[model samples]
Target: MPIADLLDRFRPGASVYLPGATGESLALAQALAADPDRLRGVEVTSCLLPGMNGVDYAGLAPDARLTVFMLPAATRESFAQGRVRLLPLAYSAIARHIAAAAFDVAIAHVAPPDAGGRASFGIAADFSPIAWNAARQRIAIVNPHMPSMRRGSSIALAEADLVVELDGPLVEVAPARPDATARAIAGRVAALIPHGAAVQVGIGGAPAALWAALGDHRGLRLRSGLASEELLALADRGALASDGHVAGIAAGSEGFYRTLADRDLIRFADTRETHDAGRIGREERFFAANSALEVDLFGQVNLEWQGGRPVSGAGGAPDFAAAGIGSPGGRSITMLPATAKGGTISRIVARLSSPSVSLPRNLADVVVTEHGVADLRHASLDARAEALIAIADPTMRDVLAEQWRSLRTAMA
Candidate 1:
């Protein structure tokens, strides 16, 4: 059927699900945006990542509403105007929410069917399966450029459900080249992970540098929520224990996606399996590395909310951190630059700028900054303050110490 015909099928006030991660159907999203009349009075639900997928679904039509777990830059305006509904759910909880929403239509961007009549998710295996099951109808905009993979998530391709064929490249994010500060933190974090350890790292320069720093380690495995382009280089340098890794979604450049598809290097999983603490803890030497906006003396971490609004989401940070903490032989590692805003502000302070249960003190087994590392797992309140202060930016140390003293005086 024609793409126009599919757009015409949408009823006013209907609920729709747009797949997140690389499975997002840009063709459909663009069509809906171009033809606002089709999306008016419709409710759109998605988990569009912060850095990717900049379409403003809620703004497509005044009556349309977007419900999402992430508060990316694109949605900030809509959210403030009451057009977007922000769901403060963990990465795993969002999956459960999707199963219950029961959207009227689900748009799936996929690779063409293989010889066996199967379409794989290619780089995205995050939420398509759940979205498909919860929707009344599923429409696949088959893209030939979308790589077909032997591993990761796949669904049976049915000709009857094929609505339109679109030719476009899937979204790609270039790997962030680490700067000196990122490299320093990465080096320290890398030293903490022993050989043969399993690690989960979030995206960004610190992670990119950490991957490069681990080139000499052997028997290392990846058990992560996300896989990026760095995995390609790590594999090339023989840093990984095996070619097969467990990742919920692969987000990176076109070259990396193609390489991942060609090599079939990872097993795609959903948030449930990837973030389950028990399952994650079963693996020995599991380390979850996450970033934080700030850390208090007690080590409460924050990944979301900045400048009076949310710039990010909790995502899988808490999920993986909890798993690493519970794993008897594993540890949770939190890495951040010691300062922000060109050294004008400190990231480690007497108190977090905004704390809302992102990650508790217990999850902060080890905190690494460019200056040094703070092993907070076995430390007391004062000891944690001391260790954290030691790792803080040298310029901010005296001020942080004074603040800590003031806090203690008030408590006494």
Candidate 2:
């Protein structure tokens, strides 16, 4: 009935399905944070996306153990302490895991009820529907500030056992201003995308520049896991179709959220709908432009692991990559800068030293960097290595070529 009661349930160590990313409810999180004892010995599970949700749940509850799909910076300390366990799952697989958990409570942040008595999942719809449906108890923070999403994303408010009314600012991603390098990389990606294509572009400076580069594109559809603020600019320029943009979640400034609600630009979809291969395959031109930490000579991608630990989850990238690569007329494009770590390290490596290969070489149709584009589709093994090395940072190219030769010699 009230948030006080909700906090009471949490203190007793109820298995909670507190969603992160755009589904995060700052109201409930603050309420629990206000009383540290409320979180003691609690077991929390979430798919807290890296770089999206920064709350340190284990820090708040000293005795609490957390289970997360991705390792965000906020949770790194806990992870290092063995208080957090990671599940390296795809976006669709994460939904399946949440369904199996049957958590005691599933708390969601939703738009206030409309005249039709339905509360929209609003800014976040990726995994909320699955959690809400599978949990033994349902709670919703009825946030007036949450965008009122229209379409199949709304749920009846009566379904939630506890409905807490809260009016406060939601979590947001600061708007990204693409730099010259990002713009150059995005320019190459823009040229590869045809007008009227459905694109799956993720967040960050490169994607923001991708939208700016497509300023003249018409009738484009955005089918991405998360919507960046750049969607507004595209919509303003008539580059994006009115009803063509859809995403599983929205991450941007609060002002962007308001404009999205006012313009009804993004239709939020569940993970099943957004990541469905069959659904994406049906789209005429499903070009997925995703970021990767590194790509080896064979074009294998590593998007998750860095150093010796997991920094991010695979999420929907694999789903969209496979779907886009398999799409009859669509191509899967992986975009990244030529270097990382302030230009000291090469993103194009001779071999993926990371223990994880988030995406296989088969899904790598094209690789784009500020330097140039590498079309690896239907290429031979030797040809693939040469093409990838050609696009590598000029200084690193020689080193990578030597490494590639070593690999080939070893293979022989």
Candidate 3:
């Protein structure tokens, strides 16, 4: 069918759901944005918009609104300008939210059908399955460049109501190269992981460094929201367990996607399975490593706000952190540099100035900085504060300690 013809199907006031990350249909979204008349008053919802197509949300017709679950660099400006709606939901709850909202249309990028007429959801499978099941209209942009996978990660052609076939490259994200600080934090985090552990790694320099530092570990398994090149390298090196890895999405260079093509070593499941706390808790020696913008004396983690403004969403950090911490013989680790802004600002503070709390103190097991690690798993309020302040940047440790003491005195 013609791509323009498909745009005609959208009705005013309709709710449209699109997958985020690399699963977004670039050509289809561009076509939709180009014809504002067809999309007038339509509500388009998606997460982690990479902004590869250069679609201007503010330029879209006045009635159309773009709702984003996770704020990306491309949409940050628009969000600040009040041109986009931001919904803060963890990756695990996205499917439920979409289903409850009863979106009318689902647009997804998928691989071409195989001999069995099944198409893979490709690099992203986070909420697509749920969106497809809940939406009244199912539309797919079939891209030959996408890799086809096994049963659990694919959808049948019979499910799609409209199909627009286009051959193009899937979106790719270059891995964050770790620096000296990240490497130091990664070393401390790596030391905490046990052999034959199931790991969940979040996105950022610290997690990337941790993945790179785990080459020597044996029988590691991945249960994560997003898989990067480092995860591929581990599997290639025979360091991962033979049981295969579990992921909700894959966001890496083209080489990483090719590695996943028709391979059974990694199984792409929906967020429901990948982010389920109960399921993750069942894994032996589960370890989750996440990055944070700030950690306060009370052990609260802030991953979203910067300078008192919303910068990102919670994503899967909370789910994985709590699950990993609750699992038997498991641990949740948060890593970040002790300081920012040329060491002028400390990331470990006596109080969080931001409104968004990614993880509460109770869920925090370990906090790691380039300077050292703070084990808060079984610490009292005063002990937690002391441990955290001790691992802060040397220049700011005394200042944080004084602030903590003042806060304690005031409470008393």
Candidate No. with top lDDT: 2
After superposing candidate 1, which stretches have Cα over 4 Å from the reference? 159-162
> Distance (Å) between predicted and true CA of 294, model 1?
0.9
Enumerate clash totals for all models, in the order shown: 0, 0, 0
Error of 1 at 309 (Å): 1.9
Please give, for residues 319-362, the per-residue lDDT of candidate 2 as tens digits: 89888877878998888899998899999998897997999988
Write one digit per residue (lDDT tens) for candidate 1, span 135-213: 7888777788888778767777673354578887688777788999999999999998888888899987798899888
lDDT of model 2 at residue 67?
Answer: 91
**lDDT of all the models against the reference?**
0.84, 0.86, 0.83
- 330-378: candidate 3 lDDT, tens digit per residue: 9989999999999999999999989768888888789999999999999
The TM-score, computed over Cα atoms with residue i paired to residue i, of candidate 3 is 0.96
The weakest ten consecutive residues by lDDT in model 3 span 50-59
TM of each candidate vs. truth? 0.96, 0.97, 0.96
What's the lDDT for residue 49 in model 2? Answer: 80
